[model samples]
Target: MDDHRIFAESLAAALAAEPDVDVSAAGSGPAALRCLERAAGEGRRYDVLLVDADLGGHASGSRPAVPVQDGDEEGLVDGISLVAGVRAAQPAVRIVVLAEKDDARRAALALQAGASGWVAKDCSLSRLLTVIRGVLRDETHLPPALLTGVLRELTAARRHRTESERLVESLTPREREVLRCMVAGLGRKAVAERLFLSPHTVRTHMQNVLGKLGVHSTLAAVALARRAGVGPADLTGDVVERGSQLA
Candidate 1:
């Protein structure tokens, strides 16, 4: 989806002119998600989605046609996040990110979010169409200029994730639980209540976790846990039962 109406419509028209293409356009991330949902409901899913890399976050005038459902992903704060949202909703659809310029960092993130191709918006229509066809055939495409930097960015992320996982692996099971609660933004008292431990015991566990993770502060530990793919403990359910399961 693109916020620029003129570009969206013109590109749609151009693609529609092709003998084997069917094109649709949306001017905002919410509108784009709506289109995907509607198409899925009708049993006619889109084969490819070309998304503006900067939609939702800084669109000049994005007017979603439908009222957003409460707690829907906020029309995607940025295109990278929208790529992830679309991937979650439609796993089979090939996604291509359209950016204003070649950004290796954003392109790497887009690839991680399931985009099969990344291209500059100023690229020729013929080039974009070719990439679309290529992705449909299960080939990934990236601009040549972006190859080196994108690879570097992805490698660095991988290294961080690996190191974070190693540090997290060093914690004891109880320490790990305490760390999970900490990542959820729970205080020592809250963690004690949820985990059914005494507050002093919780404090000891938290300190042990920080020491094991080799972090000086809770915030640094939280960041490391996230890099390790550790998510917060669910706090909404019955805490008594939840704590029992962990036992």
Candidate 2:
């Protein structure tokens, strides 16, 4: 959804022109929510939602938008909250943030709120379509400019390794081994074979890894591990170092 009806409708129309594409538009977050609710009641699910990051401004063909403050989850005036709301209602649905500016902070907030991807307003229509399709395939489409900033922010939040080290300490020896394999780009079956464990055991360890890292995806967990200096080469030594504590 966007605050400007003309932009939203124009974009929706352009998308609708594509074969096998069904597109809709909303002028505000509330309208979008209402639309989602109605669709849910009708047993119709949306494949993806495109929401503008700064939706608190005036909406075209609708009432003045509600003002949303930063970090307000209940307020539907902004994309972050809308993303969270949509995620809460439909865990499997993919949401993409549409931003007029490359504001890293806003992009970070939207992603943290469960947005699967983001698109800059200045991007071409083809690019937006590609992002939507990529998100549908479960690929995160973070802009390179935003991704560098997001990674920096993520790494900067913990200058010292104390917190990350503590999180790593929480993992079992088996889980640490699984994470090490993950950092090396091993699939679950590969990790299982390498670790001499059942595939089911490997899956369980992967779940534990995600839990300890407080991330949803293995890619995210691996990134956190690399940032925390827990690369594959260090995995064996790190496990030994944490052995006494785990015991």
Candidate 3:
């Protein structure tokens, strides 16, 4: 949700022009929630949501003060709050925060709220669309810079790569192969094709991967793996060779 009516409408229009896509717009967080409810009532659900960091200007008088964590200093309207609210409403909907600038705090907050992606507002529509598709395929768009900071933030809360590493150790060889492809942003069919496996086999591997990782979704598994440094960068030829050597 955003306060800018023109910008929101323009974005919705552009997205609607894409093939096999439907677009809807809301100027505020509550409005967006209402739209989601209405869509659900009609047996429809959104796969992704693009939320503005700032929901809008003050409704009538005072700007809303967002709740912050122990170390957070700012009390202004935090878009991360909206991300959490949206997650509460629709746990399955992937969320991408539209940031006005590249702020580390904003990125960290979004990640902490379980947002799937974040993109600067000034980024090209093509980039945003790519991010949307990527997130839908369970890819996190966190740049290395932001990821470093987010890792530190999570570290402070006793939730960091160490935990992910522990979980990773529990994965089977086949499950690690599945996770490797997943971290590379491959969908189930693509992963199955690449691994020379049937779709049913891929699904089973994915479920085992999720269970071993102690996560509910593929995105969470990939995120945890990346946080533990078992990301696309680590899925090198040597890694592939190791997987192949497995019985």
Please provide, for model 1 over 48-69, each residue's C-alpha lDDT reduced to its tens digit, 9 standing for 90 to 100: 7777777654456542211111
The TM-score of predicted model 3 comes to 0.54
- lDDT scores of the candidates, listed in order: 0.75, 0.67, 0.67
Question: What is candidate 2's lDDT per residue for 1-247, written digit by digit as tens?
Answer: 5337666667777776776576666667777777666666876667677777776433443321122111111112224456776787777767787776787777767776788777777899889778877777789998887888987765665554567777888888768767878988889987766666778877888998898789999888888887666867343333333323432
On TM-score, who's better, 2 or 3?
2
List TM-score per model, in order. 0.82, 0.55, 0.54
Q: How should the candidates be ordered by TM-score, best one leading?
A: 1, 2, 3
Which lDDT value does model 1 have at 148?
Answer: 100
Where does candidate 3 stray beyond 4 Å? 1-3, 56-79, 159-247
Q: 146-221, model 3: which lDDT tens digit per residue? A: 7777777766645666788889989887788788899999888977767767799889989989988889998898
- Residue 36 accuracy (lDDT) in model 3: 71
